[model samples]
Target: MLKTRTGILLLAPAIVLMVALLVLPVGYLIRFSFYLGQTGVQTSGGFTFANYVRLFGDGFYLAILWKTLWVSFVVTVVSAITGYPLAHFMWKAAKRWRAPFTILVLSPLLVSIVISSYGWIVILGNNGVVNQLLQFLGLTTAPVKLMYTNFAIVVGLVHIVTPFMVLSILAALEKIDPLLNEAAATLGANRFRTLWHIILPLALPGIGAGTTIVFCLAISAYVTPAVMGGSGPNFITTLIYHQFVTLFNWPFGATVAAVLLAVALTVVFLYVRVLSRLGAAAPAAR
Candidate 1:
């Protein structure tokens, strides 16, 4: 009883903080979503489902939601594909090389997202480094359209999220027993075979963690998509901003936010379910 009391006391502050900061705001946002709006402005308090109805009923909003999901999926996949090899290398590299490699992988995180987005803009812009290089190489007569495209947004998001993926995979890799690799080798298993059968299975948890984090972050990401994706390839966050700031439709903005929150939660739940199934099946496979 005393230990339980002490634990509760210790947790009280954190619980209070969570309620005050997160729960309260979400509750308020939910309430706000139910309010009615007119001509891009929220009216006096009255409960209505019109905002949600319009969000689901309209084709434009649905298209934006689909685009957001697609962009997030692409970013997560690219981050995982690029991060896995880098993480493996980091885990297997000599002690002297690990620090530098880790730093290189993590350097982007130390910088601000806005700065990073601008850096990508410089590299991916029409007259930027990439186009200049292509011109110098005599590869093209005109600059390639890189900026303000879905490809550019994906590239930026991949760059931002790759560090998270690498760290997650590295954490999992570090937990793996090196003896497992040696044992497989002694059993006449080749490197590729060991990696495919041993390393990958063990690393699925990390990959799943990284993918979930990257997907969540990418789906909610505003600055990178806004700056790189421009006006056409608008994301959910961008639409929320448009409703809240541009149009001053507070009720509708809250509705969009609620929908985004629901979608994010659904994706996370499905991802967890899938990962759990994979985790359960791995032991049987082995």
Candidate 2:
């Protein structure tokens, strides 16, 4: 009873903060989403499902949502693929090399997102460094259009989110017992076979966590996509910004936000379910 009481007391501040900051704002946003907005102005009217109806009924909105999900998926996959190997290298490196390599992986995170996005523009723009190098190498006769595309957006997002994935996977990898690897080696398992049979299964939880975080961040990213994607691809976050800031349609913006929140929650739910199943199955597989 005393321990339980102590635990509740310790959690009291966080619970209150969550209720005040997160729950209240989400509740208000839900209410706002139900309000009516016309001609870029919110009308003083009762709740209606028109906003949601229009969101799902309209093809443009659906396209934006789909594009957002697709881009986010691409970014997440790329981050996972690239980050996992880097993380593994860091984990396996000598103690002297590990710190520097870990810092290099996390260095980008210290830079501001806006600065990072603009930096990519310099690299990816027509007549930029990439094109210049390619031309010098006689790979292309002319500068390729690289900026203002989904590809650019993916590149920028992957740069921003890869650090998170690396750190998450590294944490999981560090927790794994080195003895397991030695044991597998003794059992006639090669490096690749050991990684496939032992390391990957143990690291699934981290990979899943990193993937979900990167996906969520990528989907909701605004500045990176806006600068890199430009007018080529329209994402849900861009739409929400346009509605709220450009059009001044607060209610409709709120509705779009609600939809985005729902989609993010749905993805998180599915990821957690899948991770739980994988967790349960890992020991069984062994």
Please give the CA lDDT of all the candidate structures: 0.90, 0.90
lDDT of 2 at 222: 91
The local distance difference test score of model 2 is 0.90
lDDT of 1 at 18: 100
Candidate 2, residue 252: how far the Cα is off, in Å: 1.0
Tens digit per residue, CA lDDT, model 1, 1-286: 4698899999999999999999999999988889886655447657888888999999999999989899899899889999999999999999999889978999878888999999999999999999999999999989999999989999999998988999999999999999999999999999999999999988988998999989998999999988999884388999999988888888898899998898789888998899889879878987
| TM-score for all models, in order of appearance | 0.92, 0.91
Candidate 1, superposed: residue stretches over 4 Å from native: 38-45, 278-286
C-alpha RMSD by candidate, in order: 2.2, 2.4
Q: After superposition, which runs of candidate 2 have C-alpha atoms over 4 Å from their true positions? A: 1-14, 38-41, 281-286
* TM-score: model 2 vs. ground truth: 0.91
In model 2, residue pairs whose N, Cα or C atoms come closer than 3 Å (at least 3 residues apart or on different chains), thus clashing, are: none
Error of 2 at 32 (Å): 1.1
**Top TM-score prediction, candidate number:** 1
Query: Which digits, one per residue and each the tens of the lDDT, describe model 2 over residues 128-210?
Result: 89999999999999899999988999999999998999998988998999999999999999999999989997888889889
Q: What's the number of clashes in each of the models?
A: 0, 0
